[model samples]
Target: MGEIWMIGATGRAGRNISAELQADRHRIVLVGRNGQRLAEAAAAIAALGGPPPRTLVTDDPLAQIATGRPDVVVNTVGPFGATTVPTAHACVAAGSHYVDLANEFQPVQSLLGLDPAARTAGSTLVTGAGFGTLATEALVSELCAGRPSPIRVRVAAMPVVDGLGPAVLASVVDAAATGGLVYRDGRLTRSRLGAHLQHTPLPDGTMRATVAVPTGELEAALNASGAGDVIATSSEVPTGRIARVALPIVGAVLRVEAVRRTVIRLIDRWQLTPPATPGEVSWAYASTEWEGGETRQAWLQAGEGYAFTSRVAAMVATRLADGDARPGAFTPGALFGADLARSAGATITLDSNAKDLR
Candidate 1:
């Protein structure tokens, strides 16, 4: 069995991925900042009738990865903007595979930019191994397969997460601070934070409101469809008229270093109510248009967002550890194909005909 080191093992996503890895017979090493929490998480893993996980309490996860090179390292920490690049670099230097559930645009693009380095180091790096990026990315891939590059592409993520964690909140804040982005004429361009508002039609005959956000799904869709223009929207963010008016101002304010830090601190200390699950299904929609007016649209349907993310992260880490993936950097669907989504308990529906492809 390959040795898998899970950073932030005390966190929700970390614990779930650790359990999945252990259940698959991989040796797990739980790494976190809190010794007690790490020990507790290890005990929980041991209770699952698998080999008890080893624990490492460290403030510098990069140093640990460099010193004790595990076969694979799964990072559940965020804002991934701060953590992803450095940690992935450490794993590459140590000749270890790296996987993270990062869905932020900057981090995901930064990590994928490491493709050459990872290949040279014989390491595999997977980012956005989660719902937002993977679900939409898989749909884009399916729509574009065996077809020419699309002229335009639009993707929407509507995840029904069960709860909110501090890390997630921090990531959201960081993404907001990064401002809005879209691919225009094959170039990354800045836009208003809540621009390109769309009412995406779901498979269940429901319409969900989404607004453009600078998410990794934007990068994923661009890469998958080779579209000259791409916009990634999400239902998670407020898209009302007032929200649209204020988003640009809020984003500008958060861009200040001190202000962002202060906001993150407040989020950490505040007692956030457990986010109620919005619905039973999470949907990701993608529409691709060709130059000749031919168009294709598809939807990826899955269960709770967190559960799918945990499974996708676990599956990616395990496959990397088992040497089942090639040496390079990629998002999950980019590396493993759309079938990865299906294996992680998602189904794809194509166009008005609503043909379900497993």
Candidate 2:
């Protein structure tokens, strides 16, 4: 069994991924800031008839990781803009594989930029191992397969999450502060936040409103389709008319370093009410246009977002631990192909005819 260490072991995604790894009989070490919470998470795992997990309470997880050097590290901590690069660097230095559920634009691009270092260290680092990036990225990959480079690509993520967390809120603030970004002529371009508002159609024959947001899915789509122009949209953000008018102003205000930090600090202390359970299905949509106006569209249908994220993170970490991945840095689907989504309990549908891309 591979030795796997889970950072933020007490959080929702961490706990779920821990259970998944336990079911596969891998050895897990729970790492967190609170000793009691870590112990409780370990106890919950043992209560499921699995072996007791080792728990490590440390304020400095990077030092612990560098010292212990587990075979694989799964980082569930968010504001991944701050956590992903440092943790992945530590893992590379320690010669361990790394995986994280980061869907922010900067962090995802920065992590993927570590490909040379990871290859030199013989370590695999996978980022965006979650619904937002993988769900749409996988579809783009499928639609672009066996085709020449597309001229334009658009991807939309519409996940149904059951709850919110402080870290999630903080990440949103960080993303908003970064403003909106799109790929134009193979270059990253800045745009107004909440631009390109779209009334996207779902597989269920209903329409959901989405707005362009700078997200990792944008970078992932560009890489997957080799498109000269790419834009990523999401339904997670407020997309109403009022929000559209206000988003650019809000983004501009948040761009102030002090204001952004202050907002994030307050968000960290928020005790938000748990949201109602998500609907039965979530969908990620992507449409690609080739040089001569040949266009292809696809969608990936899955269950609740959090459960799918847990599964994807767990599967990616497990595969990395098993030496099934190449020594480099990549987004999940970029490393494992579209099949990674299928393995994580998502189904892909291609074209207007609803042909299955399984």
Candidate 3:
């Protein structure tokens, strides 16, 4: 249905996005710094279904792509803490929609300024398309579906058990080292990771997820949602048959980057993780307390968070190609509404756990 230029298509998360989109018969154009990696991604995705998209490797991507053209450019480039401006500029110049898997908060401060330029250029720009806050944002939204006086949002996510690449490992450490973005008294503030804590429950049982500063994704999502008394947080959750016993230790480890760093080095050095698999699961729930009546709640458990992000990204690309989505820089939540976000392939849960809270 669409041609999406997939940058960093070989990364594990990027591959997952491509895998799901491939099932839908969407054509993925693999773009990366390396021709070899891009070719490998192209072949793999092509095998899934649909014709392989035009693969291009260029230092000057905009100059190179001015001719063949694409519907949208899905950037898989890491840390976008560094290279978003040029890519955003190129996408507008190429007349293509732009999306990235960036999670850094500093970059968004600058990118948000692109709203006017993007509107004038007629291009849609979205970043933080990764796993950071999309699911959490949706959870918070479905939690407060009805008009509620005040809503409380909390989230915890960690990849402690998964097979993480060096880059992924590096990103996690960097994000942690910088402490977290904290929202206080309606102002964006800062907090050290593991500074605050709460024991949150999972399908299995209860675990501790510390409160930290929300990333750009969470910040944008909450601001756009415009909920009353809303606070969102993301932290690591430890799981295992005997893992519950280790929550305190895990929580302690996450608090200090030096401690976490040693552990990550050991993980990398030892090959402790499983196969770098494409499937990743993200589960989130939210609660809403209104002025009267009863409180409402909703929870979501998903098996395909990575791919769904890609599928939604493809939808973004295709629409940008057709000139449907609004032009300008935005977070996924800034786009707003479950109906519109569905285009990004996020499923909703009707069995809200609003009642029965003691």
* Candidate of highest lDDT: 1
Residue-level lDDT tens digits of model 1 in 137-200: 9999999999889899999999998896788889988999999999999999999999888988
Worst 10 residues of 3 by lDDT: 152-161
Please write out the lDDT profile of model 3 over residues 1-358, one tens digit for every residue.
4467776677776676677666766666666677888788878878877777557786666665566567777776654654576777777877777887666566565567777888898878887664555666666566655554343444443322245545555445445445545555456665544444544455445543634443564465455445444444444422333444444444455558577667666755764533343435555545455554456555555554555555556555555545568878887656645454555544556444535232
TM-score (C-alpha) between model 3 and the true structure: 0.74
Provide the overall lDDT of each model, using Cα atoms, as 2-decimal numbers. Answer: 0.91, 0.90, 0.58
What shift in Å separates residue 194 of candidate 1 from its native position after superposition? 0.9
What stretches of model 3 exceed 4 Å from their correct place? 62-69, 145-162, 202-208, 227-230, 237-281, 288-296, 339-358
> Where does candidate 2 clash, by residue pair?
none
**Model 3 lDDT, residue 172, Cα:** 52
Write down the TM-score of every candidate. 0.96, 0.96, 0.74
Query: Which residue segments of model 2 deviate by more than 4 Å?
Result: 272-277, 352-358
